[model samples]
Target: MTGPGNPHGGDAGEKSAPAPKKGKRELWKLIPGFAISAFFLWRTIKSIHYDDLRSLHVVQPVWIGVMIAFLLGSYTLRIYRWWFMLRRSGAAGFGVCSRVLLTSFAANNVLPFRIGDFLRVFTYAGDLNASSSTILSTVILERLLDIFTLLAFLVALLLGAAHALPPVVVRGHELNVLHFAEPVLVLCAVGLILLLFGAPLLQRVVESVVRRLPAGARTEKLQRWALLLFDAVLKLSFAGRVLLLVSSIAIWLCEGMIFVSLSRMLAIAVLPRGPWLAVALSNLGFLIPSSPGAIGVYESFCKAAMTSQGAAPGISGIYGILVHVVVFFSVTIAGGVAFLAHRMARGAASRPLRADLADLPVEMPADLPPGISS
Candidate 1:
């Protein structure tokens, strides 16, 4: 039920798997993922043109290749952005972070119940010999930054796309996407403002409160991690902040181009705002509590976006499947490779140690950079 050598031994088997009762509970949690994915996939397939699917090879291989290139570039930028943050938090090397990033993505892609997130935290903690608390804080920060960036893009898209969005009337209510999105947009906007203007004061307040507490192990640990989170935020240079936002937006934009590429290949009309909206909306699918990769959620949102842009339902459905396949395989392949290489390298390095020495615990370092303790 477990992997060969346990790096997340301290996680009480949560990393590799859950206990039977917990596992059953997690399986129950998969109901929504399965239902949503099954329903949307069924709907999508029902709309697919059998003849068009048969001739799916009509698209140019070159554009597909270009999409892959952009995907790689986008991932590179994302990893580099993470590296910047990791370094700020006292992580030492880019190599370890790179492998951890890919492995985490791969795990998330393959596993259920979002176990990959735990795997990601444990993996990073193991690689850096850092505490899970500190690494988890960084991971949380990464996701927050990512969400903020995506919300910004969505807000911008919704505002500019008011005219282009297809009409949706449900239960005799003329539903406006912009109106629905406004609340979330306002929230994100307010959060952005606070991060820009009030983070320092908040950090100071947190630091004072945490420092005044007793210095026991738990309190010390909590104090260290709390301060690390704020300090990392404070240490981000203006240029680094720009890089985070720009790289995030650029990643989504590059991904959006896949829709355009597919459209061009399929000889469909999905331009102007279709690809962008599809990209934004489809990504929002990940926020849904669905199966790994948010299968149904992504396809449904994307197909809707494409259909809104005058694309045939058949083509849009097929296009969504194609895009999902391409992205899934690409990330899995890359992540798999990185993960295996890291494991093999670690094995080789450790195998050389004397048998008695190898079993000894390697304590986490005491001298972490300021505002952090392992």
Candidate 2:
């Protein structure tokens, strides 16, 4: 994670640093992100009881190793999941997918504004010569899938466990955050279901509009892109859909192990309701926009969850920071390695910036717009 000249431990000449304007643009997008992170981070920090921070030393060393293993496993599955989506988009090969995914992950964790996401589109669009629209669609789909899965986890942990949230009394009134989450989850669940089920209808509506509109390149292209996204959304077969579900569940399981183990590592007793609730809460925090790698939002939600479970503020504070560091550094290092591997394999005669899509059978639809097939 050094400077751009050798981010992945490359030769100093591999690439120069990003230009000044580029850096500024990245920073500019992050203004809101950092502001949000700072607010939440300050809130969590103010709550910490410094005296109890000593509790961190008692965390089991063994769980630390377990947490690492789970994180690795989770990342592996994440690569596979992306590979899976790319294949559906007429791209294959796990090697390429892993490089883009890990490198993008490193970028997101290190840089600002979630710019890493565009790396997925760039790499695949260049290498596979597939529609960028399609690749971007899958990316959005992947996120929605993750969100839905996390929501499921939240719902399950809420219903299946007692003391899911610690009660708080404010001027003799009782409040628990979990109560708020329940309705939100229910509404979100309904919305997601509708989105999935309504894709075809939405697709038809867009297509109809596309047919009627007087064609201009930009407008027509945008409409077609929308059609393509809806098409991708509609096209996940039952098996592919199942795979997404299983992979999402597995990834979070790995994350939950990390969360629970790290809490143990910090020697905080999170039981009964356990780490699932903590995991759920922290992930919910991530759904909100924040600084790179969700720095403040993540810790705030985690500390909130732990404190509600009666963990000391000192324990929660240290646990949050340490866990974030573990993940942030681990993935960044792995991404660097992946970048190096990609460079080594490709060497000087790397693949073209754009390549033919001969691997998958693709046909222009007959009912498509005038310019596409004509």
Candidate 3:
């Protein structure tokens, strides 16, 4: 609630001062991230032979337009998913939620560590007067649901392509089957088991264990917060579950469509089902800790996936680069515009925060921990 470093009583002496050395260290941290991004950009450029650019001239403007449309649709669906999650938690409508999502996406593209996701939570909580903790809990649940859905889709893809894939892909499928599937299945099973039986189990465990502690106001408050968390978990009801499933499916479908449209634009008639595999694999690659936008990791995975599927190295590299550029620019521009609009609206509609801070609490305790520190 009160930030970890913020001290009690809100006095100047209680506040922590910024260290000059820490600022220098923070600046130094950016060096590696920027270097990683630069290295990837160079790799991507080197992979592109001039001769291949001449060949790519055949890609039509009309197909490119279609690809853009699919990407736009994907962004829209992402907003819709976030909106649905917020609605389940009693937040604002889709319009406000979409703007927040756009700003968040913009931040994620520009900032490191996917901070935009948490930013969306902050923005919505501020705008709607909802508990940031509740909204963030929904966000976490949304992500877990998305992962489960992606795993389901990956498994389905592997099974569908079992006979059609080449030996290497088949072997990859086997590895996925043996290595990834078991853990995923076990996790899903455990989550389900917990969801169904967690309430009574937790109640009994807490009553038996926590009752032994000194009975006081803090203990009562702890119990209250635990119940609130349990209630949040319970809010994942039938309708909420259905919405998560539907939205996850819709979002991935949009993504897959974008890939297919890109392939069409490139006039690659036989996309070989590998691009879908590549999409899933590329997402996994981006999960690794790295610089903002996962520049190197994303391109590397895309190139590897395409090359492994027998695509020309040059073509695959160019395609990956183009896809990244298109998606990045599209989201960033849209998000930036939306963020500016939101900022302008807030500025025009209300006085500066410093003016309002006199009336409102300087340190507004959050229902949950602050996310990403803005």
Candidate 4:
């Protein structure tokens, strides 16, 4: 097998050595996120005393059932929304969608760097009979919709219940939440408006930018992918867009109910609007990009929101810990079970699947959204 190109090795080009440097580089990138999580965890722990452990008692055990109910409701709505978004793509059935969605979030809970998102898009895209671009477009849209809804909830809080809540104090200074949230809210609103109304313009701009890139297989592939993002949104009718927004609102409200239920379960005297505020702030904290499951970042944000509204520091810390545990473990365990079942079923059928984008075509298909061919 020794030839001119492989004079010193057997199948030298066919089986190249793995790039250890690339693996090391990826590991190195995760160091900062872990450090950030550690720092916040330490800060959160130091603020809580041994007495905080007492707050773990469930005063009204019935609320425990309520919390679980809302948790299930939120995930159910989320799975349906994902399916609805990909309906035109001929996505899989409700059961398939649920398993994939839960497995993805479970991956996010256990793995760092939000790997679950890419996992969902790459691994299940083929099973769903949709392109990677379409799946990714829906994922990005989901995040945007969540952000918009959360911000809107925050604004509603300020308008409807700000007077009922205590001022948020940071470092002995009264903090104005609205002052900061309003600008971001405005930006998100404007972005959504533009995305929905000016999709064609966005598509054109993407084309113009793609045209400027050096002509290559990679560049052309990227062009189709970028175009597909806006194409999915553009394809939605006015009624469909409204339905999506309404559904997004329902999903977050269900999550908000979880916080409310937890507060009641523990008998923690949160303010009238405390649960909603915590929901808005804590989920928004996810934007900070901490370690898997948001770890210390989630607790810190949740505790901060509760404490600002006059909840005891010990109870606030406990509340944060309880909420994190419920969310982190439930999804991770359910997803783990679902993934194992899926694998077993596939193995029984003797079907092998590769969860990567390499098998996809470089060129857009004729069935792609109408403007993608242009």
TM-score winner among the candidates? 4
Full-model lDDT for every candidate: 0.69, 0.69, 0.63, 0.76
For model 1 the local lDDT of residue 243 reads 69
Clashes of each: 1, 1, 0, 0
Model 4 weakest 10-residue run by lDDT: 1-10
C-alpha RMSD for every candidate: 6.4, 8.2, 6.4, 6.1
Clashing residue pairs for model 4: none
Please give the lDDT score for candidate 3: 0.63
Q: Over the stretch 17-75, how does candidate 3's per-residue lDDT look in tens digits?
A: 54355446556767877787677667766777898777775465577777777788878
As for lDDT, the candidate ahead, 2 or 4, is 4
Of candidates 3 and 1, the better by TM-score? 1
lDDT of 1 at 93: 84
Among all candidates shown, the one with the greatest lDDT:
4
1 or 2: which has the higher TM-score? Answer: 1
Residue-wise lDDT of candidate 1 within 97-156, one digit each (tens)?
A: 777787778768887655556665543565765555566666656777677777777778
Model 4 per-residue lDDT tens digits across residues 1-374? 11122222347554255335544665787888888888877767777887778546778999889999999999999999898888877878888888989999998888755667867876677777776667877887888889889988888887765443456798999867677767877887887777767778877887888889898877877776666667678768878888888899999999999999989888888786878888888888889867888888888878877887788876787788788898889889999999889989878663443323223222233233432424
123-241 in candidate 2: lDDT tens per residue? 44666445666677677677877888788788777666445776678899888656766886787777566556667676677678778888777556667666655655566775676
lDDT value, residue 347 of candidate 1: 87
